[model samples]
Target: MRIQLDDLQGPEIHALLEEHMRGMHALSPPESVHALDLDGLRQPNVRFWTAWDGADLLGCGALKQLDAEHAEIKSMRTAEQHLRKGVARALLAHIVEQAQALGLRRLSLETGPVPGFAAAHRLYQAFGFQECGPFADYKLDPHSVFMTRLL
Candidate 1:
Protein backbone atom coordinates (compact mmCIF):
# COMPACT_ATOMS: atom_id res chain seq x y z
CA MET A 1 0.00 0.00 0.00
CA ARG A 2 1.10 3.55 -0.68
CA ILE A 3 0.87 5.96 2.21
CA GLN A 4 0.76 9.59 1.15
CA LEU A 5 0.01 12.97 2.66
CA ASP A 6 -3.68 13.67 2.28
CA ASP A 7 -5.36 16.96 1.43
CA LEU A 8 -8.69 15.89 3.01
CA GLN A 9 -10.66 16.80 -0.09
CA GLY A 10 -11.35 13.49 -1.74
CA PRO A 11 -14.83 12.00 -1.50
CA GLU A 12 -13.37 8.65 -0.46
CA ILE A 13 -11.53 10.16 2.48
CA HIS A 14 -14.52 12.23 3.50
CA ALA A 15 -16.71 9.13 3.63
CA LEU A 16 -14.11 7.24 5.63
CA LEU A 17 -13.75 10.05 8.15
CA GLU A 18 -17.49 10.39 8.50
CA GLU A 19 -17.67 6.68 9.19
CA HIS A 20 -14.91 7.05 11.75
CA MET A 21 -16.82 9.81 13.54
CA ARG A 22 -19.98 7.72 13.59
CA GLY A 23 -18.12 4.74 14.99
CA MET A 24 -16.53 6.86 17.70
CA HIS A 25 -19.82 8.35 18.83
CA ALA A 26 -21.42 4.92 18.83
CA LEU A 27 -18.71 3.42 21.04
CA SER A 28 -18.13 6.25 23.51
CA PRO A 29 -20.17 8.96 25.15
CA PRO A 30 -20.21 12.37 23.49
CA GLU A 31 -17.80 13.84 26.02
CA SER A 32 -15.31 11.04 25.52
CA VAL A 33 -15.37 11.13 21.75
CA HIS A 34 -12.20 13.00 20.86
CA ALA A 35 -12.07 12.07 17.22
CA LEU A 36 -11.45 15.03 14.94
CA ASP A 37 -13.76 15.93 12.14
CA LEU A 38 -12.48 17.07 8.74
CA ASP A 39 -12.19 20.68 9.81
CA GLY A 40 -10.25 19.81 12.93
CA LEU A 41 -7.93 17.55 10.99
CA ARG A 42 -7.37 20.39 8.53
CA GLN A 43 -5.95 22.61 11.27
CA PRO A 44 -2.45 23.97 10.69
CA ASN A 45 -0.95 21.95 13.52
CA VAL A 46 -2.24 18.69 12.13
CA ARG A 47 -0.79 16.52 9.37
CA PHE A 48 -2.97 13.85 7.83
CA TRP A 49 -2.19 10.84 5.68
CA THR A 50 -4.04 8.13 3.81
CA ALA A 51 -3.04 4.66 2.74
CA TRP A 52 -4.24 3.40 -0.61
CA ASP A 53 -3.83 0.58 -3.08
CA GLY A 54 -4.46 2.12 -6.47
CA ALA A 55 -7.90 3.73 -6.14
CA ASP A 56 -8.94 1.97 -2.94
CA LEU A 57 -8.59 3.90 0.28
CA LEU A 58 -7.43 1.49 2.95
CA GLY A 59 -6.99 3.70 6.02
CA CYS A 60 -5.91 7.05 7.37
CA GLY A 61 -4.30 8.66 10.43
CA ALA A 62 -3.13 12.06 11.63
CA LEU A 63 -0.69 13.71 14.00
CA LYS A 64 -1.38 17.01 15.70
CA GLN A 65 1.55 18.91 17.08
CA LEU A 66 0.85 20.02 20.64
CA ASP A 67 4.28 21.57 21.11
CA ALA A 68 7.70 21.58 19.57
CA GLU A 69 8.40 18.15 20.97
CA HIS A 70 5.00 16.61 21.55
CA ALA A 71 2.33 15.36 19.17
CA GLU A 72 -1.01 13.59 19.52
CA ILE A 73 -2.33 10.88 17.27
CA LYS A 74 -5.80 11.58 15.92
CA SER A 75 -8.45 10.18 13.64
CA MET A 76 -6.98 6.75 13.14
CA ARG A 77 -9.32 4.45 11.25
CA THR A 78 -9.16 1.51 8.90
CA ALA A 79 -11.82 1.20 6.23
CA GLU A 80 -14.42 -1.35 7.37
CA GLN A 81 -13.80 -3.64 4.42
CA HIS A 82 -10.07 -3.45 5.04
CA LEU A 83 -9.90 -4.36 8.72
CA ARG A 84 -7.31 -6.95 9.86
CA LYS A 85 -5.44 -6.32 6.63
CA GLY A 86 -2.60 -4.30 8.20
CA VAL A 87 -3.93 -1.04 6.83
CA ALA A 88 -4.01 0.56 10.28
CA ARG A 89 -0.62 -0.86 11.11
CA ALA A 90 0.87 0.63 7.97
CA LEU A 91 -0.71 4.01 8.58
CA LEU A 92 0.40 4.01 12.24
CA ALA A 93 3.95 3.00 11.42
CA HIS A 94 4.06 5.72 8.80
CA ILE A 95 2.73 8.29 11.28
CA VAL A 96 5.34 7.31 13.87
CA GLU A 97 8.11 7.51 11.34
CA GLN A 98 6.90 10.90 10.20
CA ALA A 99 6.73 12.12 13.82
CA GLN A 100 10.32 11.08 14.40
CA ALA A 101 11.34 12.76 11.19
CA LEU A 102 9.73 15.95 12.47
CA GLY A 103 11.97 15.74 15.54
CA LEU A 104 9.03 15.19 17.88
CA ARG A 105 9.98 13.59 21.19
CA ARG A 106 6.70 11.98 22.11
CA LEU A 107 3.52 10.59 20.58
CA SER A 108 0.25 10.16 22.46
CA LEU A 109 -3.36 9.23 21.81
CA GLU A 110 -6.76 8.89 23.50
CA THR A 111 -9.09 6.01 22.71
CA GLY A 112 -12.24 4.47 24.10
CA PRO A 113 -12.11 1.74 26.75
CA VAL A 114 -15.04 -0.29 25.43
CA PRO A 115 -14.82 -3.74 23.89
CA GLY A 116 -15.34 -2.15 20.51
CA PHE A 117 -11.94 -0.56 20.89
CA ALA A 118 -10.08 -3.68 21.94
CA ALA A 119 -8.27 -4.09 18.65
CA ALA A 120 -7.10 -0.48 18.77
CA HIS A 121 -5.76 -0.88 22.32
CA ARG A 122 -3.83 -3.97 21.32
CA LEU A 123 -2.44 -2.25 18.24
CA TYR A 124 -1.18 0.70 20.26
CA GLN A 125 0.32 -1.50 22.97
CA ALA A 126 2.14 -3.55 20.37
CA PHE A 127 3.57 -0.31 19.00
CA GLY A 128 5.01 0.45 22.48
CA PHE A 129 2.35 2.83 23.71
CA GLN A 130 1.59 2.60 27.45
CA GLU A 131 -1.30 3.89 29.52
CA CYS A 132 -0.85 7.43 30.76
CA GLY A 133 -2.82 10.24 32.29
CA PRO A 134 -4.52 12.83 30.17
CA PHE A 135 -2.38 15.22 28.18
CA ALA A 136 -3.03 18.39 26.23
CA ASP A 137 -6.59 19.71 26.64
CA TYR A 138 -7.84 16.34 27.84
CA LYS A 139 -9.21 15.63 31.30
CA LEU A 140 -9.33 12.34 33.12
CA ASP A 141 -12.45 10.37 32.29
CA PRO A 142 -13.64 6.81 32.69
CA HIS A 143 -14.61 6.53 29.04
CA SER A 144 -11.15 7.46 27.81
CA VAL A 145 -7.90 5.56 27.77
CA PHE A 146 -4.73 7.59 27.26
CA MET A 147 -1.53 6.13 25.90
CA THR A 148 1.86 7.60 25.07
CA ARG A 149 5.38 6.72 24.03
CA LEU A 150 8.62 8.67 23.98
CA LEU A 151 10.18 8.93 20.56
Candidate 2:
Protein backbone atom coordinates (compact mmCIF):
# COMPACT_ATOMS: atom_id res chain seq x y z
CA MET A 1 0.00 0.00 0.00
CA ARG A 2 1.08 3.55 -0.74
CA ILE A 3 0.92 5.82 2.28
CA GLN A 4 1.23 9.55 1.76
CA LEU A 5 0.29 12.92 3.23
CA ASP A 6 -3.36 13.80 2.73
CA ASP A 7 -5.02 17.18 2.39
CA LEU A 8 -8.27 15.89 4.00
CA GLN A 9 -10.41 17.25 1.21
CA GLY A 10 -11.43 14.14 -0.61
CA PRO A 11 -14.93 12.79 -0.11
CA GLU A 12 -13.55 9.33 0.61
CA ILE A 13 -11.44 10.65 3.48
CA HIS A 14 -14.25 12.82 4.75
CA ALA A 15 -16.53 9.80 4.87
CA LEU A 16 -13.85 7.72 6.54
CA LEU A 17 -13.19 10.34 9.20
CA GLU A 18 -16.91 10.75 9.80
CA GLU A 19 -17.22 7.03 10.27
CA HIS A 20 -14.27 7.10 12.65
CA MET A 21 -15.89 9.80 14.76
CA ARG A 22 -19.13 7.91 14.89
CA GLY A 23 -17.40 4.72 15.95
CA MET A 24 -15.51 6.49 18.69
CA HIS A 25 -18.66 8.01 20.06
CA ALA A 26 -20.48 4.73 19.89
CA LEU A 27 -17.82 2.86 21.83
CA SER A 28 -17.11 5.54 24.43
CA PRO A 29 -19.17 8.12 26.24
CA PRO A 30 -19.24 11.67 24.99
CA GLU A 31 -16.69 12.82 27.58
CA SER A 32 -14.39 9.93 26.72
CA VAL A 33 -14.47 10.41 22.98
CA HIS A 34 -11.32 12.26 21.95
CA ALA A 35 -11.41 11.65 18.23
CA LEU A 36 -10.95 14.85 16.30
CA ASP A 37 -13.37 16.22 13.76
CA LEU A 38 -12.42 17.25 10.25
CA ASP A 39 -11.70 20.82 11.33
CA GLY A 40 -9.58 19.69 14.25
CA LEU A 41 -7.50 17.42 12.02
CA ARG A 42 -6.96 20.39 9.73
CA GLN A 43 -5.11 22.27 12.46
CA PRO A 44 -1.68 23.56 11.54
CA ASN A 45 0.14 21.39 14.05
CA VAL A 46 -1.54 18.18 12.84
CA ARG A 47 -0.17 16.15 9.95
CA PHE A 48 -2.55 13.59 8.44
CA TRP A 49 -2.01 10.71 6.06
CA THR A 50 -3.97 8.09 4.17
CA ALA A 51 -2.92 4.59 3.15
CA TRP A 52 -4.13 3.37 -0.23
CA ASP A 53 -3.94 0.23 -2.31
CA GLY A 54 -4.04 1.65 -5.80
CA ALA A 55 -7.47 3.33 -5.92
CA ASP A 56 -8.77 1.93 -2.65
CA LEU A 57 -8.33 3.87 0.59
CA LEU A 58 -7.07 1.41 3.15
CA GLY A 59 -6.92 3.60 6.27
CA CYS A 60 -5.77 6.88 7.76
CA GLY A 61 -3.86 8.26 10.77
CA ALA A 62 -2.38 11.48 12.08
CA LEU A 63 0.23 12.99 14.36
CA LYS A 64 -0.45 16.15 16.31
CA GLN A 65 2.64 18.05 17.39
CA LEU A 66 2.26 18.97 21.02
CA ASP A 67 5.62 20.69 21.31
CA ALA A 68 9.07 20.76 19.81
CA GLU A 69 9.96 17.25 20.88
CA HIS A 70 6.59 15.61 21.56
CA ALA A 71 3.69 14.46 19.43
CA GLU A 72 0.40 12.63 19.87
CA ILE A 73 -1.06 10.04 17.54
CA LYS A 74 -4.64 10.78 16.62
CA SER A 75 -7.53 9.59 14.47
CA MET A 76 -6.12 6.19 13.57
CA ARG A 77 -8.80 4.21 11.75
CA THR A 78 -8.92 1.29 9.34
CA ALA A 79 -11.73 0.77 6.94
CA GLU A 80 -14.26 -1.78 8.13
CA GLN A 81 -13.63 -4.03 5.14
CA HIS A 82 -9.86 -3.77 5.58
CA LEU A 83 -9.53 -4.96 9.15
CA ARG A 84 -6.72 -7.47 9.89
CA LYS A 85 -5.09 -6.62 6.59
CA GLY A 86 -2.28 -4.58 8.18
CA VAL A 87 -3.81 -1.24 7.24
CA ALA A 88 -3.56 0.16 10.76
CA ARG A 89 -0.14 -1.40 11.17
CA ALA A 90 1.23 0.21 8.05
CA LEU A 91 -0.19 3.61 8.95
CA LEU A 92 1.30 3.32 12.43
CA ALA A 93 4.73 2.32 11.14
CA HIS A 94 4.66 5.24 8.76
CA ILE A 95 3.58 7.62 11.53
CA VAL A 96 6.39 6.46 13.80
CA GLU A 97 8.95 6.78 11.06
CA GLN A 98 7.71 10.27 10.22
CA ALA A 99 7.82 11.28 13.87
CA GLN A 100 11.46 10.19 14.13
CA ALA A 101 12.27 12.03 10.94
CA LEU A 102 10.70 15.16 12.43
CA GLY A 103 13.20 14.93 15.30
CA LEU A 104 10.48 14.25 17.81
CA ARG A 105 11.68 12.58 21.00
CA ARG A 106 8.44 10.91 22.04
CA LEU A 107 5.21 9.62 20.57
CA SER A 108 2.05 9.26 22.64
CA LEU A 109 -1.52 8.16 21.98
CA GLU A 110 -4.85 7.76 23.79
CA THR A 111 -7.27 4.99 22.99
CA GLY A 112 -10.27 3.38 24.64
CA PRO A 113 -10.19 0.43 27.05
CA VAL A 114 -13.25 -1.27 25.60
CA PRO A 115 -13.29 -4.57 23.75
CA GLY A 116 -13.48 -2.68 20.49
CA PHE A 117 -10.03 -1.30 21.20
CA ALA A 118 -8.35 -4.62 21.94
CA ALA A 119 -6.59 -4.81 18.62
CA ALA A 120 -5.44 -1.22 18.97
CA HIS A 121 -3.93 -1.87 22.40
CA ARG A 122 -2.05 -4.86 21.05
CA LEU A 123 -0.86 -2.91 18.05
CA TYR A 124 0.57 -0.12 20.20
CA GLN A 125 2.15 -2.56 22.59
CA ALA A 126 3.84 -4.46 19.77
CA PHE A 127 5.39 -1.19 18.66
CA GLY A 128 7.02 -0.75 22.08
CA PHE A 129 4.46 1.61 23.55
CA GLN A 130 3.91 1.33 27.29
CA GLU A 131 0.95 2.43 29.36
CA CYS A 132 1.31 5.87 30.86
CA GLY A 133 -0.64 8.47 32.73
CA PRO A 134 -2.45 11.20 30.91
CA PHE A 135 -0.34 13.67 28.96
CA ALA A 136 -0.89 16.95 27.18
CA ASP A 137 -4.39 18.31 27.92
CA TYR A 138 -5.76 14.94 28.97
CA LYS A 139 -7.05 14.11 32.43
CA LEU A 140 -7.44 10.78 34.18
CA ASP A 141 -10.41 8.87 32.80
CA PRO A 142 -11.22 5.22 33.25
CA HIS A 143 -12.40 5.12 29.67
CA SER A 144 -9.03 6.14 28.33
CA VAL A 145 -5.79 4.23 28.03
CA PHE A 146 -2.73 6.30 27.32
CA MET A 147 0.46 4.89 25.86
CA THR A 148 3.79 6.38 24.99
CA ARG A 149 7.25 5.52 23.67
CA LEU A 150 10.50 7.44 23.64
CA LEU A 151 12.19 7.90 20.34
Candidate 3:
Protein backbone atom coordinates (compact mmCIF):
# COMPACT_ATOMS: atom_id res chain seq x y z
CA MET A 1 0.00 0.00 0.00
CA ARG A 2 1.14 3.54 -0.74
CA ILE A 3 0.58 6.17 1.95
CA GLN A 4 0.98 9.82 1.12
CA LEU A 5 -0.19 13.31 1.98
CA ASP A 6 -3.51 14.00 0.34
CA ASP A 7 -5.36 17.02 -0.91
CA LEU A 8 -8.83 16.97 0.51
CA GLN A 9 -10.15 18.01 -2.89
CA GLY A 10 -9.08 14.71 -4.42
CA PRO A 11 -12.03 12.57 -5.48
CA GLU A 12 -10.70 9.44 -3.79
CA ILE A 13 -10.41 11.21 -0.47
CA HIS A 14 -13.87 12.69 -0.85
CA ALA A 15 -15.40 9.33 -1.66
CA LEU A 16 -13.78 7.66 1.34
CA LEU A 17 -14.97 10.40 3.69
CA GLU A 18 -18.52 10.11 2.39
CA GLU A 19 -18.35 6.39 3.03
CA HIS A 20 -17.04 7.07 6.52
CA MET A 21 -19.92 9.37 7.36
CA ARG A 22 -22.45 6.87 6.09
CA GLY A 23 -20.90 4.10 8.17
CA MET A 24 -20.89 6.29 11.26
CA HIS A 25 -24.52 7.26 10.80
CA ALA A 26 -25.50 3.63 10.47
CA LEU A 27 -23.52 2.46 13.48
CA SER A 28 -23.70 5.32 15.95
CA PRO A 29 -26.11 7.98 17.14
CA PRO A 30 -26.05 11.53 15.79
CA GLU A 31 -25.32 13.22 19.12
CA SER A 32 -22.32 10.99 19.72
CA VAL A 33 -20.86 11.52 16.28
CA HIS A 34 -17.75 13.67 15.88
CA ALA A 35 -16.36 12.68 12.52
CA LEU A 36 -15.12 15.50 10.33
CA ASP A 37 -16.84 16.52 7.15
CA LEU A 38 -14.85 17.88 4.20
CA ASP A 39 -14.81 21.44 5.51
CA GLY A 40 -13.63 20.33 8.92
CA LEU A 41 -10.95 18.03 7.49
CA ARG A 42 -9.56 20.94 5.49
CA GLN A 43 -9.03 23.06 8.56
CA PRO A 44 -5.61 24.61 9.28
CA ASN A 45 -4.87 22.41 12.26
CA VAL A 46 -5.34 19.12 10.48
CA ARG A 47 -3.33 17.02 8.00
CA PHE A 48 -5.00 14.26 6.03
CA TRP A 49 -3.70 11.25 4.14
CA THR A 50 -5.03 8.62 1.80
CA ALA A 51 -3.73 5.12 1.23
CA TRP A 52 -3.84 3.68 -2.23
CA ASP A 53 -3.05 0.38 -3.84
CA GLY A 54 -2.15 1.74 -7.26
CA ALA A 55 -5.39 3.18 -8.65
CA ASP A 56 -7.57 1.91 -5.82
CA LEU A 57 -8.15 3.93 -2.69
CA LEU A 58 -7.72 1.64 0.27
CA GLY A 59 -8.30 3.93 3.23
CA CYS A 60 -7.72 7.36 4.81
CA GLY A 61 -6.78 8.94 8.13
CA ALA A 62 -5.88 12.30 9.63
CA LEU A 63 -4.19 14.04 12.51
CA LYS A 64 -5.58 17.11 14.21
CA GLN A 65 -3.05 19.14 16.15
CA LEU A 66 -4.49 19.94 19.53
CA ASP A 67 -1.56 21.95 20.84
CA ALA A 68 2.23 22.02 20.70
CA GLU A 69 2.64 18.56 22.18
CA HIS A 70 -0.54 16.72 21.41
CA ALA A 71 -2.50 15.55 18.38
CA GLU A 72 -5.75 13.71 17.86
CA ILE A 73 -6.40 10.94 15.36
CA LYS A 74 -9.34 11.49 13.05
CA SER A 75 -11.38 9.81 10.34
CA MET A 76 -9.58 6.46 10.19
CA ARG A 77 -11.53 4.25 7.85
CA THR A 78 -10.68 1.36 5.57
CA ALA A 79 -12.76 0.57 2.52
CA GLU A 80 -15.15 -2.31 3.13
CA GLN A 81 -13.32 -4.44 0.59
CA HIS A 82 -10.03 -3.71 2.35
CA LEU A 83 -11.22 -4.41 5.85
CA ARG A 84 -9.18 -7.17 7.60
CA LYS A 85 -6.58 -6.74 4.92
CA GLY A 86 -4.30 -4.44 7.01
CA VAL A 87 -5.27 -1.11 5.45
CA ALA A 88 -6.40 0.47 8.71
CA ARG A 89 -3.36 -0.88 10.55
CA ALA A 90 -0.99 0.57 8.00
CA LEU A 91 -2.75 3.93 8.03
CA LEU A 92 -2.70 3.97 11.83
CA ALA A 93 1.00 3.16 12.09
CA HIS A 94 1.74 5.86 9.53
CA ILE A 95 -0.29 8.38 11.51
CA VAL A 96 1.55 7.55 14.72
CA GLU A 97 4.91 7.85 12.98
CA GLN A 98 3.94 11.26 11.62
CA ALA A 99 2.86 12.39 15.07
CA GLN A 100 6.20 11.38 16.53
CA ALA A 101 8.04 13.06 13.70
CA LEU A 102 6.16 16.27 14.42
CA GLY A 103 7.44 16.18 18.02
CA LEU A 104 4.06 15.27 19.37
CA ARG A 105 4.64 13.47 22.67
CA ARG A 106 1.13 12.12 22.89
CA LEU A 107 -1.63 11.00 20.57
CA SER A 108 -5.25 10.74 21.59
CA LEU A 109 -8.44 9.81 19.84
CA GLU A 110 -12.18 9.40 20.28
CA THR A 111 -14.02 6.46 18.76
CA GLY A 112 -17.51 5.09 19.20
CA PRO A 113 -18.38 2.42 21.77
CA VAL A 114 -20.48 0.57 19.20
CA PRO A 115 -19.77 -2.95 18.06
CA GLY A 116 -18.64 -1.73 14.67
CA PHE A 117 -15.80 0.10 16.38
CA ALA A 118 -14.62 -2.80 18.51
CA ALA A 119 -11.77 -3.76 16.22
CA ALA A 120 -10.51 -0.18 16.14
CA HIS A 121 -10.45 0.02 19.92
CA ARG A 122 -8.54 -3.23 20.11
CA LEU A 123 -6.12 -2.20 17.39
CA TYR A 124 -5.29 0.96 19.27
CA GLN A 125 -4.76 -0.83 22.53
CA ALA A 126 -2.40 -3.23 20.80
CA PHE A 127 -0.41 -0.20 19.75
CA GLY A 128 0.08 0.87 23.38
CA PHE A 129 -2.90 3.20 23.75
CA GLN A 130 -4.72 3.16 27.06
CA GLU A 131 -8.09 4.41 28.24
CA CYS A 132 -7.95 8.02 29.23
CA GLY A 133 -10.27 10.84 30.18
CA PRO A 134 -10.95 13.44 27.54
CA PHE A 135 -8.15 15.91 27.12
CA ALA A 136 -7.59 19.29 25.51
CA ASP A 137 -10.99 20.82 24.68
CA TYR A 138 -12.90 17.54 24.59
CA LYS A 139 -15.59 17.04 27.17
CA LEU A 140 -16.74 13.81 28.70
CA ASP A 141 -19.30 11.97 26.56
CA PRO A 142 -20.96 8.67 27.28
CA HIS A 143 -20.78 7.20 23.81
CA SER A 144 -17.18 8.16 23.19
CA VAL A 145 -14.26 6.04 24.31
CA PHE A 146 -11.08 8.08 24.68
CA MET A 147 -7.66 6.50 24.29
CA THR A 148 -4.15 7.88 24.47
CA ARG A 149 -0.55 6.79 23.89
CA LEU A 150 2.58 8.54 25.03
CA LEU A 151 5.03 8.88 22.22
Top-scoring candidate (lDDT)? 2
Candidate 2 lDDT trough over 10 residues, lowest sum? 14-23
Q: For model 1, what is the error of residue 49's alpha carbon versus the real structure, in angstroms, after optimal superposition?
A: 0.2
TM-score of each: 0.99, 0.99, 0.96
Instruction: Report the C-alpha lDDT of model 3 over 91-125, residue by residue, as the tens digit.
Output: 99999999999999999999988888899998999
Candidate 3 residue spans exceeding 4 A from truth? none
- How accurate locally is residue 124 in candidate 2, as Cα lDDT from 0 to 100? 98
Residue 64 error for model 3, in Å? 0.2
Q: Give the TM-score of candidate 1.
A: 0.99
List, residue by residue over 25-111, the lDDT tens digit for candidate 1: 899889889999889999999999999999999999999999999999999999999999999999999999999999999999999
Cα RMSD to native, each candidate?
0.5, 0.5, 0.9
What does the lDDT read for residue 88 in candidate 2? 94
Q: Model 1, residue 145: displacement in angstroms? A: 0.1
Model 3 TM-score relative to the real fold: 0.96
lDDT of 1 at 140: 95
